[model samples]
Target: MIPIHENLKGKVAVITGGSGVLCSQMAIELARQGANIAILNRDAKKGRDVIERIQTSGGTGISVKADVLDKSSMEKAREEILETFGQVDFLINGAGGNHPDAVTNTETYQDEATGKSFFHLDENGFSKVFATNFTGSFISSQVFGKDLLQAKAPSILNISSMSAYVPMTKVPAYSAAKSSINNFTMWMAVHFAETGLRVNAIAPGFFLTTQNRNLLVNDDGSYTVRSNKIINGTPMKRFGKPEDLLGTMLWLLDASYSGFVTGITVPVDGGFMAYSGV
Candidate 1:
């Protein structure tokens, strides 16, 4: 069980992609702190499973099948959440991942031996990733920000990545989209400052999640070449866990902890950003 924050008790939180590995863990942790969870996902079974876990753990929760990229889907999700939870105290935009097609097999650009390089990348694939990471958050905020603003201390937490700070080797689309999230966080914070709604992002380092599990870990359960490089660069010399993010998550949501803080993308990268790979 995770530590419970006093301020989170009885609060309402809506998490997009809550059925996934990391976000589901976030949902569970928030539930332990007494927040009413709304798990929004494209997969009905996955979302329901998360709700079951929350309920079994003695917390209030509901699963809503919603596609983050669709504005109408988000509108329906907002209605369902308001109907069930009464209010949205916090919003977590956690739906986004990199596609294999948007990534290059080779790190550096090559003249004759380009492997999934920029020229070979699919335009449709690039657009899809951008829509999910940046556009989805934009529309979801539009739908949920209304109700969040009604709460005494409204907060919108976005899941950014270390790639946003220092673009990773091969995932250009993911990097650009996450960079947009950081910029949008600042824009939203400033836009809603007078309304007492805080906007911030958590830029996490490499974590073994379903989205990139194959990329980081091999079929034999060994670390991939990229994973080894990441570990070596990190001061901690290890990958992060879902639990590692809870402290910052709670601090950003609880007004007492960060009443004056806003527009910051806090890196939870275990010194990955600090090291210059010397």
Candidate 2:
């Protein structure tokens, strides 16, 4: 069972990409804590499904059609959320993913590699990945900043990745974008420090999500080479479950638990960040 934070009761939480594997779990858990959830996704149906689950569990929430990359879209979402919830207490920037075109088929550079290489990476695809991951978060924050600042105890939680710390192979665009998220989190935290708007991030380790499932799993249902390497590197010797992120997320979002904490990215990696591959 997930722990409940009393401070979250009756507050409002806005989660971007709330229909995704990880963020969906966060939306449900926050709802369980009595927070009114606003789930934003480009796919309205998927967002509504999450809301249905929340409602079935006796929680309050709404699904909003939004594109994190578009400021106007986020603005509309924010307006709807405010209309329903009256205020915004938390913002979770959870909308980010990698495109196949932005990735290199080979781990390292190769002069004669037949597959797509770094030199052949599609500029449009790379730009889309970077914009979706980094620019989306930036836009969402801007659209919601005023409402968050007005709250008595507001916070912003960004979803980062383990790649942000150590750039992973084959996905340079994803790595660079996540790294920017870490820096942006710190920058926003300091910018709003005196305003009581805390900004933090959760850098999740290797979790199997739609975005990385292809890279981590094979058609035969066995772990891919990359997945095995990840497990070996993780001190816990396993890929993280979605629930693994809940505790840290709650701790960071709850002012009673982490009021003084800001401008930091907490890694929920099951010791992945600590292991040195000795």
Candidate 3:
């Protein structure tokens, strides 16, 4: 809304999965920093809403319907961004999710003798989870990174998860995919270091959102066993808010602040990764 050129105004930022909860917040915050946010998401209406909010706040943004798994779709979106802003300065590869199929029925449910829960972990589901989260982010990096070479300074931020550090049980696919993202962030950072692009990642702890609301709280506003365990394990003793990540996001995106930083996967958890749960 206010004049932005002082800090990060006039920069172009692309956020995949921008329609989702966390990325949507980043889009808004980045816009507030004077960036032209290009929101790319498969969901048309949700992306539109994020754009609308950015516009309402007097920040600039545009919504692009895209599938992170599809290269052509990402290139088209990149073309659209070039048409709108001429260059991309920041890229947030935020498209990812867990599939019900990739998770076992319970954390310690290894009763293959009964074969009850093992049957639930379908191969098709595992494929979907891997495709969407891991493969999609990888493809998006390639597509948008083409422009980074020409820009003065460009940045790539990937979304990882707490699962990457410690497997929480059940969601083996999610853990694997996030771990890949973590590793890829470092690899890409080095691979592109000479090209003026800084690649980094954020591994968030449990954040209550529409995606994981059922797992955290009940309809009556009570915490579940899973949620309690998470709280107890975390030294901070609670789940994270989406806004809790904005500080880290801002620090990483601004070149003036973290110019020398790259290949780092900063954990924005509530000390969850640090605590041994003693």
Write one digit per residue (lDDT tens) for candidate 3, span 27-146. Answer: 998888888999998887899999999999899999999998889988998899899999988889899887666767667756554532756788988888878888998898889878
Residue range 1-278, candidate 1, lDDT tens digits: 55668889999999999988888988999999999999999997899998898899899899998999888988998889889878999999999997887988889888888468778889999889988899989988999988988998999999999988889988999999999999999999999999999999999998999989988999999999999999999999999999999989999999999999999999998999999998
- Per residue, candidate 2 scores C-alpha lDDT tens digits across 113-160 of 799999889999999999999999999999999999899889999999
Report every candidate's CA lDDT. 0.91, 0.95, 0.86
**Model 3: how far residue 143 lies from native, Å:** 0.8
Which consecutive 10 residues in model 3 have the weakest lDDT in total? Answer: 1-10
Mark the regions of model 2 whose C-alpha exceeds 4 Å error after superposition: none
lDDT for 173 (candidate 1): 93
Model 1, runs deviating above 4 Å: none
Give me candidate 1's TM-score against the actual structure. Answer: 0.97
Q: What are the clashing pairs of model 1?
A: none
Tell me model 3's lDDT, rounded to 2 decimals: 0.86
Ranking by lDDT: 2, 1, 3
